[model samples]
Every structure is written in structure tokens, then in C-alpha cells.
Target: MGFATYQLDRTNIASALTGGFASAISVNQNTINLGNQLMFLGVIVLEIPSNVALQRIGPRRWISAQVFIFGVIAALQIFVRNRTGFLLTRSILGLAEAGYIPAAMYTLSTWYTKEALTKRIAVFFFGMFGGSAVSPLLGAGLLKLDGKGGLSGWQWIFLLEGIWSIVASILLISLLPERKLEAPEKTISSDEESVSKSEIWNKATSETISLRIVWKTLTNVYKWPHFLATACVFSTWSPLTTYTPSIIMALGFSRIKANALAAVGSLITLPVIVFFAWLSDTTCKRGLTVMLSIVCYLITLIVLRCLQPHVGKWSRVGLWTAVNGLAVGYHPIHNAWIQVNCKSPAERSIIVMSATAGLMAGTQIFRSDETAEFYPRGLLIMIILAICGLALVALQSCIYYVRNRSNSDSVEEV
Candidate 1:
């Protein structure tokens, strides 16, 4: 699903430029940005509602159904003949996918104890980053199918990507077990394991939507400065996967090469991401791990900005790789941090959704079509954001350290 989503977003630039889509819809340069706006807006609007729905429906059925529905919608992109149709399709895809990441987080929260969550969440997000890593090469190859069977290359891209999604949906629906009432054996500590089934049932059942429930969830999520900070931090990175190929192309790479080259940053970041996740989990220092990545960005972006255009391909790739490598660790670390801190199911749902919405909000900066190729403005903004993120990590780390010290002091007094 992550792969399909990235495939769709990553292909938008190429699709517009070469897939005959621009001609079909009489689209201007802003058409792609407009599509992204509508899609992200849909995601924002439907995020909370989608989580509510997820609670009512089990994760297995709700998530699988979302995959299948969006898969169909994605494949339907081949049939769109107008800008309106394109916008409508993207909007629907967003609606289908709105809560998916959060829902996955929530599902993980249910299955794993807080202490054990980072690595598992890291693995889960590996799918997302993995999808991002693979989509460009895959899309580049599929572009060759253009003009086949009365379809353009972009249409083939959408069709093939959607077909893969449909197959994945089928596998998910068939293989994923129904939501169990308790965490699987050994997933939680003995104390948590000993939680009475009735008490667990009550907690789950009590989470139904109400005005008070919504208010409480919102307030709880809002009061957590770390959550807000993390959300803002993630927004800066969220659109990178979608737009990096265009940036690479601006550096003199061809469309196919640009797309294929885009994969390398994500590919290189995979192990680094995993290792940091392990470090964060083992040391219980997620803030430090995330800060290291952000500082890497600060340095990389400064150097990248200094480098003039027409730099060698390897130089460009090397810089972009550093940027992605330093930036990609945030998702898993931040997500695990949120889930670990948030115990209530309702609270976790709202936090995840709100964080996602914040990330989407942050992506609005990338909506500039004029800057699509180089994103000078985006780079400056991200550099500033990296500094801000560094501060937030510091604040969060201080807060965590203080809280831990206070707990220890109280224990000693007792």
C-alpha cells in the first residue's frame, strides 16, 4: 500500500510531463500541485473520521477494505479524461487511505508493549520507506509501456501500480487475523499481561465516539508538546519522497534516470533507519536519535545549497542520499515515541491522526509548481525546519530526563 501510494505520487511529475495526461486534461504546470492539494485536503478532512471508523470496524476488515477500495480508485486513474476527473480520483484515494498509517500504528500499539514498540514500528514503516525506495525504479520501467493497448505510459503506471495494490489487498484480507482481544503472548509485561479480560473489554468498549470522547482525545493530544513538535518535524520530510525525483531531474538527469536515481536515497537510508531505531529502543533515547538525523539534514542542506547547478551526477546523488539518510529515521522513531507515551486507544488514535494531518499541512509548502524542479524555497524552509526540529528534540529530551528524574526521586522518597 505504501508502495502504491508512493508510486502514484512519485509518478505524478513524469505522468504530467510525458504520459499525455497534461494534454488530455489541458493541464498547466500547477495541475499536479492542484491534484496534491485536493488529495491531501481529503486526507486531512477524513483522518479523524477514518480512525473512528477503524475502531468500529476491526483493523483487519477496515484496513483491507481501504487497500482494495483505493486500489480500484488508483486503477481508475487510467480512465480519467479531465482535470476534474483526476482531482476527484486523487481525493477519493486520499479518503480511502486517510487513516491507514495511524491505524497501523494503533494496531501495533495494541499488540506490543510500549518498550517493545520502536523496532516493530520501525519494521512497519520499513514498508513505507521500502515502497518509496522501489517505486521510482518500478515506475521508470513501467513508463516503457506507454502507448501499449491504447494507453499512455502514465496510464500503464497507474494501472500496474493499482493491480499490485489489489493483489496486496487480497493477501491482507486473507492472511491477517481478526483483531484479538489481548496482546499476543509475551508482547506485554506480566502486569499488563495480567490485565483482566473484562477490564480490557471495558476499556475497548468505552472508547466509542461521543462529544466528550472527542474533546478529551483532542485535548490530550494537543497538550502534548512533543506530539505537536514531532508532527511539525515530520511535515518537513513527508513530501520529500514524492518530489525528490523532480529535484534530481532539475540537476540535469533525464526523466527515467531521475526516477531511478530517486530510489537510491531511500535504499541507502533503510539500514541506517533500522540501526537508529534499534539504538533508540535499546537506549530509550528516541529524542537523541531523531536529533542526530535532523542535524545531519542541517549540515547536508547547507552544503547542498552552496553547491552550484550542473554539479556531477554522483555529487548530486551523494548530497541527496545524505539528506534522505539523515531525514528518514524520524517516522519510525517519532511514531514509536507517540505510541509509547500514549496509552489510551482513543488518545493514540487522535494523536496519530493529528500528527498525520500536521505532516500533510507541512507539505503545503511543496505545492508550488514553479519550484517543482529545484525547490529553492522548499530547501530554505526545510533548513529552517531542521533547526526548529533540533530545538524541539532538545526540549523533549529535557522533559523526558526531568520526568524520569522526578520519578526516581519519588521512588527513593517512598
Candidate 2:
């Protein structure tokens, strides 16, 4: 999903920011922002399976369903030209991709103890870096095909890229393991696993998440201050995924050059993505790792708004590069942290899906108003969110301290 966005956003911005093109387009900021919100519509499609399918269909059948669905979506892009066809293809792809992130993290939860979950999450989220790194390369390559065959290369870009996702879905199923739960005995095979996931969610989740129980998990999710704080951090971090190239253009770079520089930052994240995951796993300091990452992000926003306007191309690239690498780290920790705090698997799925939904509900919180001008004002707002996140982190730390401070007597006796 991250890779798809990287290519789509890069290509979209490349076209939008080109001087001779799109000068006649007269849509309001709301419309363009609405297009961006289509991403969340995409998210909704993806999260449905994650929230409802894993336990309902089970992993084996659901994954097999996803693989079959992936091929169909890819093939649809092969012949479709109308908006309806295109939208249907994307919405289906969205549903297929949606099952991945939260599902992967939740799957990781089953693998490691709580202390080790954060690192696993960081490794999983390295896809952002991987996607970012590859997106520009893909975009820059695709831009070369722009005028070929009287069809926009962007169309071909979509068609060809779907293959990658389809192939990936197949390979990944072989790698993902399904553990036997502490429930009634039933045999699970590769083919049956996806269907069984739905069984877990439907037949199983009834205990904690029936129509009556759903509200308990749902309402309790928002009752935590940490979840709200984390949402703020995530909502801000989102633009880095979808709008980094836009932000770079705000600093007066050409679209292609801006995207290429975005790649530079994308490249810088590789080591951090690997090493940070390792540290989070080893240390169990998921929240602390996130706090540090957000600090980098806060500093990046400051640099983009304040220093970027004044910096030379050489220095600007350096700053934006740092921004890309640092900005992505906050998410893995938050993804893991939410699950860690939840008392049950049912609640964990609820919190992950709900928080992600809130992140998608960005139109209400930080409405994207500036279409042509990359609004630096948005950065100011997000910075405040980051600070609030820090405050929440501090509160959590103090809570832990107070709870454990009195343990010295028992430790000494032992």
C-alpha cells in the first residue's frame, strides 16, 4: 500500500506541478483535498478485512481470497478506462491491501511477547522506507514514458504496478505463519487458513464484540488519552507519506527534482528503519522510541518551514532527506503501542482500526485548504500535536514510575 501511494503521489504531483500542464484546472482546495481523502476511502476498504475478516474468515481463507482478489484488481486495470471501472478496481485493491498493516502487526503480536512486539512492528513498517525508496525510482522511470502511444504513462504505470502487488501477496502468504489458538481443535492448512480467520473474528469475537460488546471496545478506545495523543501524531505523520513532494515544491523546487529529493530522504531512512526496529525489539521502549522519532519530525517541520525557504539546494536536500528518514519512525512505535495497551485481541483490533479511521478523518481535524500553496501553517498545527504527544509520553512515564517506584523493597529482599 505504501509503495502504491509513493508512485501515485509522485506521479500525481509531477503532473500537477508541471508548469505548462493543468493551468486551466480551477477546482477549490476542498476538491483536491477530497481527492486526497480518497486515500482513506481506500484505507476503509483495506481495514475492513483486518478488523472483521481475520477472526471471521481466518488467515488461510482470507489470504487466499486476497490473492484471488489481487489478481482480479490487477487485471481490471488492464482494460478499464472509465472512472467507474477505475474506482471499482482501486476500491477492490484498497480492500485487499487494507488487511495488511494492522493484520501484520497483530500477527507480530502473536509472535513476540509484549516487550518484543515494538521491534517487530518497526521491521514490518520498513515497507514505508522501502516504498519511498522505490517510488521515486518508479515514478522517474514512468515519467520517461509520458507521451508514448497517446496514452498517459501514468495509466501504464498503474497497470504494470498492480502486478508487483499481486505477486507480493502470493509470496507473503507463504511466509506468514498461523498459530493454533487455544480454542476448539480444527486442522488449518494453507488454503483453509484465510477462511478460518473470518471464523475467529465472527464466531469467536462474539464473546467480547457482539453487537452489545462492540461498543465496549469501541468506546473504551477513545477513553484513553494516549490513543488521542497518538492519533494526533499519526495524522500529522500522514502527509509525509502522501504529500512530501508537495511540501518540497513549497520550497520552490521543480516537481521532478522535488520528487527526486524526496527519494533522497527515502534513501536515508534505510539504516534507521532496520536499526530502530532492532532497538525497539531489544529494549521494549516502544513509546520512548516513538517520542525520539517525533522529536526528529518536529525538528523537520521547523526546518521545512523556517530554514527551507532560505537554504540552498544542497542544504535543502539534506534537510528534507533528514525529514523523510525521521518522520516515518513515529508510526511503527505507535502501531505497536496501541496493541500493547489493549487488554484483549478484540480490543486491540478495535483500537488499531479506530485510530487509523481517526487518522483518515483528517478533513475535520486538519483540513487541507491550500491547494497550490503547500501551507506551512499545517506544519505549525502538527507541531503542536507532536508536543501534545510528548506530554502524553511524559504522563505515561510518570505513571510507570509511580507504579514501580515502591518495588525497591521487594527487589532488595529478593
Candidate 3:
């Protein structure tokens, strides 16, 4: 619920900001892009540190506090009269929201086995994507209150979503479970047993959040591929999330109708995400499943790029909806794969946080100017990045396969 409310505010504010808020504050496209970049910057800076704090203060307290602080900052956006105010509020909100996702993910990892983690993470992401799907719909309705209480439609959107976040934070404070570390389970394979014998793995049950642990996790060679792959693929999502409604509006729809229509793709995403999660768990092939999901997204991008000029507005809408629906289908599976490969809980915390920081780096990919040409340059960039990400995923999977086979051979020899 907390994540859902946060995502609702995050996405709802985007639609509102680009429409009514931009006009109200007299800010240009560059200002909007810069504000978003700065917000993501703040999140990148605080991601690891926030995870450290989560370890010290506990998930219930730390996460709830984060939710409440960001909610307040989001609500305060209603007062922004200029670009500086807008940028400042956005940065502060990012700081407040820094580690909520990773914190929640780490907490879930502590409770579930590797086999179960993908489905659980999918359910967790359902909250996020669910909020995303609902945001534009809610915004469409709230936009009708444009002149009520002397507040603009954008102001009403922010105010209501912010209030919902606050309420959800309070609920989280009462409901979130305290962290409880469990003993490591016995491994069935030689590769798994080898991991259990590692020095870091021995410390898997530790509750301490030491600087050394953090540094070690940061330097772990195994995690960099995951981080880089995440950055590459997630960068592509920035333009989609920020510009979809505007793009729909450009197709000759009214602002309210565009906002309402934007929800269709995200609504489609909910079931697609669930299906991919099931596929990953059922096949026990996380990498290949993620690759398949990415391929589906890449196909949409390719088709959209090729046929966009020839298609009618309705056909473009269908293509865009397909793109949005496939955008995040692989995310939960990738996260589970990362967690399953980590040797310790501390490592999971740091790597998860770092991977999310990579995602933050992606928010700057879609420039304001790119929208003029229907993002030909942006789409090309995303295609290239997706290919790079796909290659990395394949390489990492092969590496693991070879290493596991070698380990099994050595065990048989012994």
C-alpha cells in the first residue's frame, strides 16, 4: 500500500506537471526535464545510504518515515510559483523516496527462498504498477476540479495523491513487520554449497550494517553486470513514463482524454507482469525469461519506430500501449535473479540499492527536444541500450552456467 501510494503520487504528478502545472508555473520544457533529472540525482545520491539506515533503524520505521517525508514534500509542490521552487521540491521528494523499493525488496528477500522470490517480487511490483495504472485515471477526474478552491487541476492532483501517500504511510507504520533474520538453509547442489562456504555467506545472518560490508558489496565483481544491465534497460522507461500522456495528446486528444487513455497501457502491464513472473518461476530460467520479455519490448520499439510515420493515430495508440505494457515485464525477474546470486543479506541490500541508482541514471535519457521529432533519437538510443542489456544478461547467465558445471565436476572428482 505504501509503495502503491508513492507510485500513484509519482506518476500522477508527472501527468499533472506536464499539463496544468507547467502552464500555471510558466516553466518551459527544459525546466521540467532538469527538475526530473535533479530528482533522480537526489535519489541516486541517497540510495545506498538510505539502505544502510534501513538496516540500522529497521524497515518499518525507516520505510514509513521515508513515505511520510516524501508525501509531505509532494504536497508542498502545490506552492511552487517558479522553476527554483519546482526543482527544490522535486529534489527533496527524491531524497525522501530514495530507498523505499530496495528496502522493501531486501525485506522480502529475507523471508522467501530463491524459488519463491520472483513471484513475491512480482506481487510487490503489482503495487507499483497498479498505482501507475490508476494514476492517470485518477488524474483525469481530479483535473475536472481545475478552479475549485482556487487550486489548479495539477494542484488538486498533487494534493490528493500526496494525502493518500501520507495515509498509506501511517498504515505502513502500524502494519509493516519488523526485520527478523533467519538461518541459512542447506544447499542441494555443489555450486550452492560452495556459496554457503564463502566467508561472506557465513555472515548472511548478521544484522550489522558496517562500512566494510558496504564497501565489499560495492566492489563485488558479480554485481556490476546486474547494475549495468539494469541501467541500460531501465533508461528506456524514462521517456515512456514522463511523455506518454503528452504523446497521446499530440495525437489530437484533449488533455483529460489523453490522461485517461494513458492508463490503458499501464493497465495492460499488470497482467503481463504477472504472466512473466509465472514464466520465470515455472521455467526456473530467470535470465532467458527476462531476455524474452525484453525481446517483446524491443519488438514493440522497433515496430513503433518503423511504422509510426505510416500509421494512423489509433494505430499509434495501439503501438504505444504495447510498448508501455511490455516496458517493465522483466524487472521483477531480474531483481530476483540478482538477489538469488548474492552471498549475504548485506550484499543484497547494497546491490539492490545500487541497481536502483542505475535506474535513476536513466531518467535523463529523454531530452525535452527529442519530443519534437517524436523521439526518433530517443527510440534509437533505447534500442541500442536494450541490445547491450540483453547481451549482458546472456553473458552473465553463461558465466554462471560454466562456473556451476566446473564446480560440480570438482565435487565429483573429490
Candidate 4:
């Protein structure tokens, strides 16, 4: 629900609902991009600290507080009269939202084993698409209320969505469960038992931030290899989402039409994601499924980039739908792929935040104001990143293959 509100605002540019904002604040694409960068920068900077707070304070209080704070921030966006206020609110919202995904995933890990985790993550992660699926249509409808009560349509969008988030946060505070922290060491083997126990004892005894724990995670997380690979793979899709509506508009659709069409594209992806998620779980081949999803994205983007201005409208829309459809499935599969490989709660929390931060970093590369229409440069950069991501996935898969073979050999010899 928090994400839905976030997406609603994030996607407003394509809906042209931000025309009011542009006029009110004398804003431009460069200013908007700076606001976006600030938000993600907040997320990147605060992610680990926020997760540490989640560990200390507990999810029910910490997560719900964040939701409530962001809800307040969302409502306050209406009062942002200048670039400074705008950037301030964006940074606060990013900070407010920073730990949410990892927190939720951490909560999920507590309830489900690795094998059963993917579908659960999918159900939760799908909220992003659900919010995205509704945003364009919601913005389009809200845009019609531009003149009501002396407020602009964009203002209405912010006000109403903010109201929704506030209500949702209240309910979330009531409904979210608090769990007791267990020693994550219990899940690992005896070979590393001594170190795991010492770490667990320190965490349990010292509620304060442990530099040792942080350093341990920082050093060993890099050794995982898949962590950076996952970050790279995840980063490839992050920028595409923020400007989806603009991309559609660039394909010759009017602003409102672009939003409505973006809605249609999101709707198309929902079931595709659900199906691929199910396939990933049942087949027990998340790595392969994620790789295929990326391949699909690469192909769609290449086609979209190569298209002529004279291309049929439906053709462009079809490609758009296909591209987003493939994009949605990657998260659940990749997330599950990462989760199962991680041996403890600490590793999962750290890696998830790092990967997500990598994604936020990728979004900074796409500048909306750089072009009035179309994103040739951005798309080309994305294509290159996608290919790099494919290479990383292949390398990770090879590593997995080698590790599995080595493990089998050891077991057989013993």
C-alpha cells in the first residue's frame, strides 16, 4: 500500500498530472531528476541503518512508523512551494520507504523456508504492480478533478493518494505482527557454528549497533559473488519503471492516453508475472527463469529502440506490454534466488538492501528532461546494462553449477 502511493506519485510525470507542479514550482525535468536522485540517495544512505533499526525496534513498530511517517510526508507534498521543499519531501519519503522491502522480506523469511519463499514474495511483491496497474488510471481519473475546490488535478492526485496511504498505515499498524528474533545461527551448519554463535550472542546481548557485525557483513557479503550479480541484474529494470508513462507518451500517445495505455500494459504483466512465479517455484529453477525473463526484456527493449516513427501504434503498444510483462517476473524469481542462497537473516537483510540500492543507483542514469520525446540514449544504455546483467547471471549460474558439483563430490567421497 505504501508502494502504491509511491508509484502513484512517481508515475505522475507521464500522466501529465505534474503540469500543475511544473507551473507552481517552475519545475523542469532536471529539477525532477534531482528530486528523484535525492529520494534514492536517501534510501541508499540510510538502508543499512534503517534495517539495523528494524532489528532493534521490531518490525511492527518500525515498519508501521515508517508507513505513517511517509503518509504524513505524502500529505505534505501539497504544501511544497519550491524546489527545496520538493527535494526535502522526496528525501524524507525515500528515507521513510528505505527499509520497507527488506523489512517485509525479512518478515517473510521468518515465516517461510527458502523453498516456499518465492511465491510468498511474489504475492507481496505483486503489490508494486498492483499499485502500478492502478496508478495511470487513477491519475487519469483524478486529473479530471483539476478545477474542483480550487486545487489542480496533480494536487488532487497527491491529496487523495496521501489520504489512502495514511489510512493504510493506520490499518497496517494494527495488523502487522511482531515476531521474536531467533539466532540465525540455527540455520547454518556445525562447521561455522562457533563464529555464528559468537555473533548471535553479541547481537542478543548488545542491542546497540555492533561494528563487528557490520564489518563482518560488509566483508563477507562481497564474497557471495551472487550479491553483486543480483544487484546488477536488479538495477537494469529500476530506471524503466519511473518513466514508463513518458515512454508510452513518447510513442505518439497523448499524455492521458499514455497513462491509460500504461495501465493496460501493467495489467498485461500481472498474470505473466504470476505464471512465471508459479513456474519458478514448481520447477525449482529460479535462476533459469530469471535469466529467461531478462532475455525477454532485452529482446523487447532492442525492438522498441529499433522501431521507426512510422511504426504502427498497436505495434509499439504490443512491444511495450511485452517488455513490462517480462520485467515484473524478474523480481520474485531473483529475490527467491538470492534468499535461498543466503544462510542467515543478517546476510539476507544486508544483501537485499545492497541489491535494492544498486537498483536505485541505476535509476539515476535516465534523465527525463534530456529529451522532449523518446529515450534513445537511455534505452541504449539500458540495453548495454541488460547485456552486462546477462553476463553476471551466466557467471552466477556457472558458480552455482560448480558449487553443486563440488558438494556432491564431497558427499560421495565421504
Candidate 5:
């Protein structure tokens, strides 16, 4: 859904649309804020209904709708001028992109056995990695604005992707196989489905749960120390992803180089993610994996903040760019650890999604008051967030230590 019109580049978009004191393209903070609100609305639209609809209407139709939405979102870029239209279109993008990652993960999980799950997940997630790697090249190329038509570069970025997305939607509709009963991903044993069905019904019908299951489930996460720490650890992951371009820009690199390096960072992330995920499987320890990742992230932020001053001196700021790449695995490891350890599917589904959703608080914090300029405030917040994440795991380790000594059962240790 990032087949988007609202350009993230500061100089590019800022120069294109300016009406206020904020020199950033987000010149009108309120308008920018409103557009962001639309983006979040898009996130919610996907987060909630995507899985539910797959169960009812099926993936074939869902994928179709997804492509249709992205296509329209792409097509609409030419006409979109104000923040309202941007927000409205981004909302569509959210809904459209919502199905892809989860559905693909579920399918991979179903199709592969536990031993093979790692490879399967890697393959599925690799789609994101590969797509992200090429996205910048594609985006920049689309933005060249040199064809016979005199469209804005951003306009070409939108329109070309929209057409591609629609074609994909049709292919998905024609090719997907129908399913009589739905379970997780592509693999569902009938017996497992039968058992799962009862559990779902029981949970649904229970008064204590039904009264406010979502609220309860959300609160349930806070009650546990592991959940709390895990959430905190996960939340600080965005600095590298969201702020890296700005970080590199602060390094005083050219916008052309900065955008190009962003793609390189994504390519660098792929292996680090896979290596860490594979390591988690090998070690059978999620906490250590998370702890190590926290350290890497801490190093990344501190080094980045320190190096920002020296960037003009370095001459190789682009080379240091891979530091963000180094920390990328932290998230994939954390996520894979959660997926591997979460025993029951219901618990897995809710907790995993919540952990992911909760972590997005980082976005709010990262983007907050930075004006999408230098994220000094954002970096400070990230440093704090990273420390808290470390403390979370440390605290959990302490709790696990005491509880295990008292009960002689270490099974629950995260």
C-alpha cells in the first residue's frame, strides 16, 4: 500500500507543497497530522477485519479487494491535492495491504512442518524484504518524470503501481483454490479444526470473555511481566526503519544518495533477519535473542547519534549506513520467537498481533514533534524506549529466576 503519493522525501515534497512556517512538506502540521490519522485508520481497517473476512468470504475475494484498493489508491494520486484526499487514499492502501503478510504467513505455516517452518517463514517474509529492497529504485525511477506525459514524478509513482496492483488482483482471483473450512494459514487438519472450532465457540460464548474480550485481551498482556517486557522490546524497533533516511540526511548525504541507501539498508536487513531467526531456532532461547538484539539497537542509536556530528568528517557515511541494517534482525528474531513459543493458536494470534500493534506506539513517539526533520527528540525517546525494552527482558529474567526456584518448573520462562 506504500504505492503512495505523499512523498516521504523532505526536499522533494516540501518544495512541491508549501503554505506555512513548517518548511517540511508537512508544512501544515495539522493537515499532515490529519493525513497521518487517515493512515492509522487504514492500519486499523486492515488489522481487524482482514483475518475475519478471510474466514467468511475467503482469500480469493479478499486478495481481489486488496488489489482493487491499491490500484485505485495508485490511480488517484494524479488528482489528490489536499491532505483530505491523501488521507482517504492512504486508508484504502491500509485496507488493501492488510491481508498480504498475515495471509502469506498463515499459508506458509500450514504448508510446512515445524522443522521446515523457519524456512517457510523466511521465504514468506523474504517477499517483504525483496519488495522493500527494490521499492526505492522503483520509486525513484517512477519519479524521474521524463516520459512523454508531463505528470509529476510522484504522480507517475502512484499511477504505474496502481495499474500493476489491479493486474495482480485479477490473477489472484482467478488462481486461488476454494476452501470449505478455514484454519490457520494454508495447513489445517480437520481434527485440529474441530478442536479449534469448539475453543473459539467457547471463548465467544463465555460471559466473562464476551463482556469485553478485546479490552480484556489487551489488558491481559499488561498483567504478565513477559508480555510487558516483550512489548517494550518490540516497540523501540522503528527508529532504524522510519528515521534512517532522515538519519542519513543528517549525515549530510545528498537526497539521491540517501534514498538509494535506504534501499540498500532494506537489502541488508534480509540476511540479518534470517540469520537471527535461524539462530533463535537453533538456540531455543527467545530471551537471549531479544536481549542481544536490544544491545545491537542500543549501539545503533548511540552510534548514530554520536556519528551525526562527525558525518561531514567521515566521507563514508553511506558505508556506516549498514548499521541500521545490522539491527533489522532484532525484530524478526523477536517476532519469530513469539510465534515459535506462543503455544496455542488463539493466544498466539491475539498476543502476537497485540505485541505488533502495541509496538507501533514507537511510530507515534518517533514521528512526534520531529517535524519529520531531525529526530533529536525522537532519538532521545528511542534511547529511552530501548533501555526500557532491555529492562523489560531483564525484569522478566529475574521473575523467571525466582519463580523457577520456587516451583521447580522453568517451562514458563520466556
Candidate 6:
């Protein structure tokens, strides 16, 4: 629900802008894009620190607080009357949302083993993809209430979605579990049995991340490929999220219909994500599945770039749907691959947050001027980035394979 709420808030403006949002604020597409850039900037700057704070404060407390703050800020978007207000609210919202995903992922990592983590991570991301699928539909409905209570349709979208987030935060505080510090065993050791109940309670409630751990994570060379690969691939996905409705509207659909139809691709993506997760788990080949998903998306991009001009309207829609549907199919599998390679909880948290920061940085590829051309330059940039990402993934796999083989040879010699 938290993840979904974030998506809803993040994309609501994109959907609303097509209806009455731009006129309400007296802003143009460039102003909106600048606001988005500021939001991502805030997220990138605060991502690491937010995760570190999560470690010190505990997930239940810190994550819930973040969500509650996010909800408040999202709701406040309804009151923005001009460009300054829009940019300010977006930046603050990004700060509040910065670490929630990585913190939740870190919490999940503590509970699940590597072999079982991908499926669970996929399930968790259902909230995000589900929210993306639903946001436009909900926006379409709420947009009809344009004059209700004297608020614009976009205002209602922000207000109601923010309230939902606030409610989700309360539920999280009541139900989210603490970290599982140890695996289950058949019997307790005598020394463990001798520990006091007070000590056990304290251990369960408190966690501390040190500066040394942070420094180590910053300097880890092995993690850079994962971060870079995520940045490049995720950049390809940004324009779709922000422009899908407008793209569909250009096909001669009504604004509301465009919003509704934009959801088709995200709806199709849910099952595809699950299938990849299942394949990754069943085959025990994380890197292979990640690469395959990326290839699938790359194919769609190439076809869209090459054939979109000659295609009929509905055929164009189909192509766009395929592109959006396949956008993030590799994300969860890639996340699982990165998590299993990390050395500790602190390392995983840092690496995950850093990777997400890379993703935020990539969102800048799409610009206001390029939207008229259906982002030809953006599409070309995404294609280039996707190819770079594939190379990085392949190189990382080779690095790991060679390192593992060398270890095996050394053990055999010993």
C-alpha cells in the first residue's frame, strides 16, 4: 500500500496535467518538467542519508514516519496555486519518499533467504505496479468531480490519494514486523539460553549502523556495476510513466479515455513481472533472467523507434502498450541479484538506495521540448542506455563467475 501510494502521488500530476492541472497553476510543460526534476533531485540527494537514518531508528518507526510525512505533503499539493508552490511541494514530497523503498527492501532481506527472496520482492512490488495500473483509472474517475466541493479534479486526486497513504502508514506501524536477526534452529545453545529476556528485547528493538560500514559501502567496487546497470535501464522507463496518457491522447482518444487506456500496459506488466520472478527462482539463474527481460524491452524500443511512423493509430497504441508493459519486468529480479551479492544488511541498504538514486538521476533524459516529437531524442537515448546496461550486466556476470571459479580452484588446491 505504501509503495502504491508513492506511485499514485508520483504520477497523479502527470495524469492531471492533461486535464486541468496546468491551467490551474498557470504553468506549461516546461515548468512541470522542472518540478519533476527538482523532485528527483531531492530524492537523489537524500536517499543514502534516509537509509542510514532508517537503520538507526528501526524500520517500523522510521518507515511509518516517512509515509505519514509523504501523505501530508501529497495532500498539500491540492493547495498549490502557482509554479513556486508546485516545485516546493514536489521537492518536499521527494525528500519524504526518498528511502522508503530501500528501507522496506532491507527489512525484507532480513526475513528471507537469498533463494526465496525474488518471489517475495516481486510480491512486494505488486503494490508499486498495481498503484501505477490504478492511478490513471482513479484519476479518470476523480477528474469527473472537477467542480465538486469547489475543487479541481486534480485537487481531489491529490487529496484522496494522500489520505489513503496516511491510512496505510497507521496500518504499517501496527503490523510491520521487526528484523529477524537469526535463522531458526532445532535447538538453542546453552549460552543463548542463558541470555536475559531484557537483552533479547533490546536486541530486537534497536539497530545501529556505523560510519565505518557506510565508508565500506561507498568504496565497494563490486556494487558499481549493479548501480550503473539499474540507472541506465531505469532511465528508459521514465518517459513512459510521465507521458503515456499524453501519447495515447495524441491518438485521438478523449482525455479520460486516454487516462484509462494508459493503464492497459501496466495492468499487463503485473503478470509478466511475476513470471520473471518465478523463472528466476526456479532456474536459479538471476543474471540470465534479468538480461532476457532487458532484451525483451529493448526489442520493443527498437521496433517503436523504427516502425512507429508507418504504423496505424491502433497499431501505435499496441506498440506503446508493449513498451510500457515490458518496462520494469527485470527490476525485481535485478534487485534480488544485487541483494544476494551484498555482504551485510548495512551494505545492502546502502547499495539499494544508491541504485535507486541512479534511477532518479536517469529520469532527466526526457525533456519538455522533445514531447512534441514523441521524444525521438529520448527514445534514442533510452536505446543507447539499454545497450549499455546489457553490457554492464554481462560484464558483472563474468566478474562473479571468474571470482567464484578462482575460489573453487584455491579450495581444491588446499
Taking all chains together, each candidate's TM-score versus the true structure is 0.85, 0.73, 0.90, 0.85, 0.74, 0.90
Looking at model 4, which ten-residue stretch has the lowest summed lDDT? 200-209
Deviation of model 2 at 289, angstroms: 3.2
TM-score of 4: 0.85
Residue lDDT tens for model 5, 121-156: 555556545655555656545545535396765566
How many angstroms is residue 110 displaced in model 2 relative to the true structure, after the best TM-score fit? 4.2
TM-score of candidate 1 relative to the true fold: 0.85
* Residue lDDT tens for model 4, 145-254: 87899987777777787788778878877988875444556445667543554455444333433566567767863235466656665675566566666667767876
lDDT of each: 0.68, 0.56, 0.78, 0.69, 0.53, 0.79
Root-mean-square deviation of every model: 4.2, 7.4, 4.3, 4.8, 6.4, 3.9
Better of 3 and 4 by TM-score: 3
Weakest lDDT window of 10 consecutive positions for candidate 2? 15-24
Using lDDT, rank the candidates from best to worst: 6, 3, 4, 1, 2, 5
Could you tell me how far off, in angstroms, the CA of residue 82 lies in candidate 3 after the best superposition?
A: 0.8
Cα error, residue 202 of model 5, in Å, equals 17
lDDT per residue for candidate 6 within 171-257, as digits (tens), equals: 989988776655333445577664554344335334445689778877777567787898889877766877788888878888788
The 10-residue segment of model 6 with minimum total lDDT is 197-206
lDDT of 4 at 236: 57
1 versus 3: better lDDT goes to = 3
RMSD value for candidate 3: 4.3
Top-lDDT candidate index: 6
